[model samples]
Target chain A: MSGREAILGNIRKGLKRSGPLAGTALELCQTRLREHRPNLIPARAQLPHAGQVELFVQMAQEASATVARVTERAAVPAEVARYLADIGFAAEAIVAPDASIAGLDWSAAGVATEARHARNGDRATVAPAFAGIAETGTLMLLAGPQSPTTLNFLPDAHIVVLDAARIVGPYEDAWAMLRSERGEGWMPRVVNWITGPSRSADIEQKLQMGAHGPIRLHIVLIGD
Target chain B: MQITSPRFKQNAHEALGDAALQRALGNLKAGFPGKRAAAVARMPEFEQLRDAARDLKNHILEHLDFYLETFEANVKRRGGHVHWARDAEEARAIVLDICRKAGAKTVTKGKSMITEEIGLNDHLAANGIEPIETDLGEYIIQLRGEHPSHIIAPAIHVNLDQVSDAFHAHHGKYGKTERQTEPRALMNEAREILRDKFIAADVGITGANFCIAETGTTVIVTNEGNGDLTQTLPRVHVAVTSIEKVVPTLEDATLLHRLLSRSATGQEIEVYGTWSSGPRRPEDPDGPAEYHVVLLDNGRSNMLGNEFREMLRCIRCSACMNHCPVYGAIGGHAYGWVYPGPMGSVLTPAFIGVEQAGNLPNASTFCGRCESVCPVRIPLPKLMRHWRAREFEKHLTPQGFRFGLGVWAWLARRPKLYRLATQVATRVLKPLGGKTNRIGSLPLAGGWTAWRDLPAPQGRTFFEQWKDRQQAGGAK
Candidate 1:
């Protein structure tokens, strides 16, 4: 028999089932996947909207990402520039191809930006976060024509501009947002939930930052 | 990949004496456990989540056939291929076939214990395909011609000097000859060297943390972004994971994901939890052109029908080893297999044959720390005891051990004789501890007394002490 059939056979033998489930038994198993539900989300993730934003900021900072709040979308460039200046990075950066971020007048803030997928040599990047999870201070970025996956990892420093309105309290809430927008059956090719800068405690168990990904993660929360 | 578990006693003995290894193991003891405790303290519903995860896992295992078929169907729907292997040899053959079809001259790999289990890199290299490990720990160990000493932290046994030595010895070919002492500098040096390989690799291979049946997604939980680069940058992305890792949905994966980093490193969450479906969509600007999943059975399917079924619930978080006293003493290399520690103690016997790996289960002290820290609530100590029982039943234990147990069992069956023998032995051994009240050495017990002195009993045996107390009216 083929490996697939043999494996299935072994599994059925182990479970002591004669064969694959048929009729309602089969549907019962499939339904679990089709209509998946969250189980016991931490009570901490069930906070109010403003509380979620506060939690996200606090948790993100705890994960070692610098957070800054901008009062308006119009003030994003200035905030990004200010963060770059504080960190001693150049004002120029590679930006993801999102219209919301691209349309921003970065030049007016004296910050030079190139809108494209991040190249291997890019030192800094500005990407748009699809959602922010307050439960763990994670940013969920979907890979699309507008947002490239490379923008999340191919740089030394990652600067993401997230709308405070999209900040969520639970990881399930972030998934719910995707389903509500794209329907239950559809999914992006890649969904990256990044919490902080890349790190490794691999060598001697000594914690080290910037391992094969961004060294610095700076989040600019646009709007209070 | 090599089975040295038959010689685990010797391996552990040498490991204990290697001062450098002991120092590295000391760091391991200082790390992981505290972080896990802190992370558990921060989450009030941690136990609740663990309960839910354990049930979810048991449920998945019961319906394993249904989930695997569904996961395969979803991957096909997402324009990906799912390959099944009944054993490691078949798994390696299938991977080699994929590489050959891709015309791959070189491939980049993320940290995958399964790939290590199947010994895929050697097969690929033998076929003239260079395999590059992208994870910093994996890379360092790979350069030193060593397998991962620890699963999560692959180079946990390698100190800073060893890492510098490996980099200094190997990085010269890449035009880097300077020695880097700081961990950050070493990480950067690896990043710079691997970036070129990531972009140039013909295929990218990684292991899946969870293979979701709901959306045809393979989730990789990592702190480093190397896995993303490994899967995203190449033309073909191949994910090699075992059959038991398949879950029914994204929600199930998330629940387990929540417990993983916290238990492994005490982080609230690892930095990157990347979920990949198929290759990049037509409209997508970047990602691989093809995606494939290789489901390896090896011996796990056999384990499911047996008493060791609970081992399948493992998420490979390394918490078991983190708190495992035996693992802390000897480190991962001494386990002499792809897996080590409490979980490995159970699995190595089941997967590689008990006769060859029987010593592994015997290595544990049954402290139950591994089970306590286990997120899936696997009864690791109970399973190790089961292995010990199996070893005795199968007559795989050493002749000396069997003879000792046989004599003890004979006396144990006769309580009067047992009590008489113990009382006499206690009196005779008492004089040996006359001055120091500790036995310096004893006949046929040199192994126990060689390292340190064995404390002598201060007075009579437990039964005698209990009789005296009852005579004095102190017993309840």
Candidate 2:
């Protein structure tokens, strides 16, 4: 027998099942998978939209990411430029091909942005987050044509633009939003839940930032 | 990779005496458990979350076949391949075949205990494929040609100066001959060296923290982002995990993730939680072109229905080890296997054999700290006792122990004889107490009293004292 068959056979024997579940067990398993019921949502995540965004900003900062709030979508370019100037960086960045970012006039804000994935020498990548999670101050980025996964990594600095409206209370809510947007059965190739800049404590348990990914993660929040 | 578990007593004795290992083990108390306590204090519902996590795993284990089949189907739907391996050799063969098909000259690896369990690096190197460990700790241990001492912190046994020497010896050709004394500088040097390996590698292999059956996604949580670079930069990406890692949905995975990082490092979440479902898309600028998953079940299938079934609920959090007093004393190397601490004590016997690993279960103090801190509530102490019971039943325990326990059990069955025996023993040993009221040494108990004195029996046995108090009409 194949390895798959033998392994599955052992599992069946271990479970003491003569065959697959016939009625309730099978039905319950299918229903649970389809429903995807979340267990024990933290009370901290049960906040209003404004409160959630506030919590997200607070948590993101606590995780060592810089957060800047802008009033509108058009203001994102200027905010990115300001953050770069404040951090003593160049005006150039590798921007994601997402239409939301592509349509923005970055050059108008005195920033030279190219629409592509990050390369070895890329200093920064400007991308749009699918959602911002308030519970842990995390940014949810889905991989696709608009938001290449490489843009999340493979760069010295990562500049993300998250709309305040897109912020959710926790990871479960983020999953629900994805189901609603992409349909229940569909999933992106990659789902990145980035809390902050990369770090390592392998040496003497001393934390040093920017291990392999971005050294600085500056979030440009597109709302009050 | 080798089972040196039968020599556990000797290994532990040596580990306790090793100056360098003792110094490294000193950091365990100051590091792991405190952060976990603080993180748990903030979340009021953390206990409830643990229950939820435990139940979900139990649900999946009962219907593992169905979930595995569903996971395979989803991966196929997303244009990925899933290979099932009944044991270690088959798992190694499947991974080697993938590397050969990819024509991989060099493979970059993320930190994976499963890889350590299967001895993947040696296997790949024997087949003329260079495997580079990208994680900083794993890299250090790999350089020293040693197995991981700790699951999460592979090089926890190595000190800074040792890391410096290892790097200096190997990095001479890279124009980095100067020894880096500072941790920051050492980390930067590793980053610089591993950067080239990541870009040049033909294949990447990582272990999945969870395999979501709903979307066919493999999730990896890492603070260093090495796992990310390993999976993303290579032409082919392969995830090697055990069969028990499969979960039903992303929601379930998220709850477990909430507990894992906090318990492991006291962080609310890891720096990066990357989930890869398949290979890169057509319009994607960069990512692996091919994706594969190798699911290995060396002995987990047999553990499913047995007394050790709860062991499968382990998330590799290291909370059990961090809180383990024995682990704190001996460090991970003394456990003499891939896993250590309370979890290892129970699991080692299952993976290896009771005869070879009986010493591990016997090594515990039954402090119950590991089970209390366990997010899944594994009842690790109870499991260890189960192993001890099995060992005794199979006559794996030493003859001396059997004789001693048999004598005690035979005496304890008759209450009157037990009282008489204890009273006589107390009377005989009272004079030996001396001014210190402690026994410095005793026959058959030299092992226990070698380090410290055992307290002598005070005035009388409890039975005699109780009878005297009753005669004096003491308070009931």
Candidate 3:
């Protein structure tokens, strides 16, 4: 039998095993669809292109407010160097080597840039994802030539330079885009979808950000 | 050892009525739904994800037998044993045999609904093997010798004081005085206690959130990190999962994962999402020497090829439970089963005969909130109706209720007689309503009237008012 036919046959077997009751199941499915209507947020809001990224950055800032450190998105190597110098982390900040920042004159930019290697007690630098999700306000870091999952999670304050043009409408659209780009062979070992800093409400249901993951998140929405 | 649904009800009542339980339940009401809303609001694609997840689950359930065979074959190929259990008794027996063969003195477990269904812990303890619950909430319930109150947050009904007390009582024997008065302190105490058990455990048993057939991987999501230690540290790791937990491929698992965590606790993803392929791979360092996957039927296979096949699509995110007004009010323990809320109400009746669990189906208000919040989109309310139908067919309902329902149905079938009876009843009862137009007590609705006063009907029926309106059209 074909793959589709085999699948259909199995479903028949599963249904027989599970039992029958079509009328009841249909009614229940309809009821579920109705209830989630209000809770669902629409894809489009009345915000301008710049405002959307700014809104995401603002929300991330609010969610990660408890953390002591935060990074803003830097457009160029010079701006990145300036930010690091301002924070007094220029001497020690470890930079992740990705294609976006590869040709930028880092030596003239006046700060040390390190390759994407695991380092202790140094702030790791990496490129911001193409488009960040506004709904979860998540930073979608795909492991490729430019971005690594470790740079986003391991560092004290992750500095992500997000290009405003890459922001998509929804997560499914984003996944569909990724699937097209990545193709079918050997999927990335890690695709980190970071929503705010690592948080836990385990203790007395009090919202405590930064339990095990990153303590701080900084997003720089570069309007080119 | 067979504690029926009625027994669970009595136990839950005793637990839920306590002041501590009420306090814990209040925390749940404020925390879960609020966070879920915030998470969903931040992601515009969440609805699309939910739809995709639901479709994927429906597709898998349609071809579950094929997936099961593929999963079983893949598991065996990876040097993992696959056991198919036709019922709860068989499942329990299979697990017990594995434990007996290994001569497991002590077993450490992660949270699993199937184990609850099979009463594995109780069975093991009866046969003289100590099954230790390593999950913080599960450990609390285990110490108290009670079943999990909720699927996600097992001890959600338990307050901090109760947790402290359970720790004080159970921790002293482990050479530690329970100084923990706070939740974090209690968690720290548990972490330390369970750490030792994890290392010394001969067998580690956990429940799979999703079992991928393509890779023969059993996926488990937990925030506490206890499941990882339980599976990796032990010599033998046994995964007990229901048939519905199987998905066709890893990609499908990922799609479901995106929906599962969001619907479960409103997180983009859980803190830990681990996928165990089989017994420790040859190159792997520090993993289980022996891996076993027990695929349990327990009346689930019967659900397939039927109208209720959609029920198998459930990812067990507990979204339905969190949104359910009944569950919110009384908590999971009140449902009197491992799978609580709307899903449990439908499932319990199916697993243990509709006659045995007639009240479970009737417990709901048919508010449809549970169905709405469900990620895989199980039509729980309609399933409850099916159970009700079964109850009526089997004559399981109380004779008085059955007779009253029969009379009501007969009257409902004849509208003219129903209108006449209503008119006469309105006339008779209007005086008893008094000036306030409310009855202090209802005659037959004993439980309904016990809580609140019943509002009295209007003196004139709708039909009477309509007839008067028709006649008074200027006598035309």
TM-score on alpha carbons, each prediction: 0.97, 0.97, 0.74
Q: Write the per-residue lDDT of candidate 2 for residues B1-476, one digit (tens) a residue.
A: 77889899999999989999988887767888898999999899999999988998898999999999989999999999999998889999999999999999999999999988888998999999999999999999889988888889888888889999999999999999899999888888998889889999999999999999988999999988899999999999999999999999999999899899989989999999998998988877788999999999999999997999999999999999999999999989888888898989998899888998999999988989999999988999999999999999999878899999999999999899999999988887887889999999988799989988988888699989988989889654
> Cα deviation in Å at residue B215, candidate 3?
2.5
Clash number for candidate 1: 0
Clashing pairs in 2: none
lDDT of 2: 0.91
Model 3 stretches with alpha carbons more than 4 Å out: A1-224, B7-17, B100-103, B462-476
**lDDT (tens digit, per residue) of candidate 1 on B81-189:** 9999999999999999999999999999999999999999999999999999989889999999999888898888989999999999999999998999888788888
Which ten contiguous residues of candidate 3 chain B have the minimum total lDDT?
B1-10
Residue B280 of model 1: what lDDT?
82
Candidate 2 lDDT at B296 equals: 94
Q: What TM-score should be assigned to candidate 3?
A: 0.74
Candidate 1 A-chain TM-score: 0.97
What tens-digit string does per-residue lDDT give for candidate 3 at B1-476?
25456555565557557777778778888878877888778667777767887877776665566567777877887789988777677788888899888889999998888899998998899999999987767888888888887888888877777778889988998887845786656765776677678768899999999887766778887755567667766789999998889876655676677677778887656755666677755544346778999887777766775556677777888888888877876777766667788888878877887766777778789999887777777789998998888888888778988899989999989999999999998887788789888778877877677667777888899999998999998598
lDDT of 1 by residue, A52-161 (tens): 99999999998899999988988989988898898898998888888988889999999999999888888889999999999999999999889999999998889999
